[model samples]
Target: MPEVFTNELNLFSGQLYMKSMNEYLSVRRFLGLRSADQKDSEPELSGSSTNVMDTETPNLIKFLRVLTMKIRRNCESIDKTHLGRILDHRTLDDSDFANGMDMDM
Candidate 1:
């Protein structure tokens, strides 16, 4: 039983980790950064050759703002979905429970 629980915990953790990684990749792609799998192969730029900060600061700021807004929207959507689920479970009738329709809770 303990081993089963440990396996389930590990599976859940792995799923969460994958979800987080996917989100990170999505944000990185949205911001025009290299994805994780491409990082190792991506070439490093020389700081002496170009002044990126001088030319790209505005673009970077815009990208960051867009990313922030997207994250906020996603959070709001998730909150609404969670709250709806909670309200639905709270409002389940006795007949719904007896019919096993409330098993989703």
Candidate 2:
């Protein structure tokens, strides 16, 4: 069977980054990266704290925001020619349209 969609969407990349950030923070605290001063500055990173998300969480959030912005910019600048190929009827499938047809009898 022929492929219906030309554009591939990788959604797990975002979730992977979040997972890695959590792992890194766990490793950092496990290795005692937190300092006494930081304990006061970022209570979440304190060894006594229980929050899974700490100071490093904000950095990951910012990175994801920037990534989302870049994706939007890329979409805005997409080459219409390539998109046209994906929109071609030969590439269209039931999933791409309502009820697999454009008109009703």
Candidate with top TM-score is: 2
Summarize candidate 2's per-residue lDDT along 39-94 as a digit string, tens digits: 44564443432323455544643444455335644433222221222212112223
TM for every model, in the order presented, reads 0.22, 0.23
Ten residues in sequence with the least summed lDDT for candidate 2: 2-11
> How many backbone clashes can be found in candidate 2?
0
Error of 2 at 73 (Å): 4.9
Write one digit per residue (lDDT tens) for candidate 1, span 1-32: 44334323432232111123333233233223
Residue clash pairs of candidate 1: none
Q: What lDDT score belongs to each candidate, Candidate 1 first?
A: 0.31, 0.32
Give the Å error, residue 30, model 2: 19
Residue 32 lDDT in model 1?
Answer: 35
Model 2 spans > 4 angstroms off: 1-52, 72-105
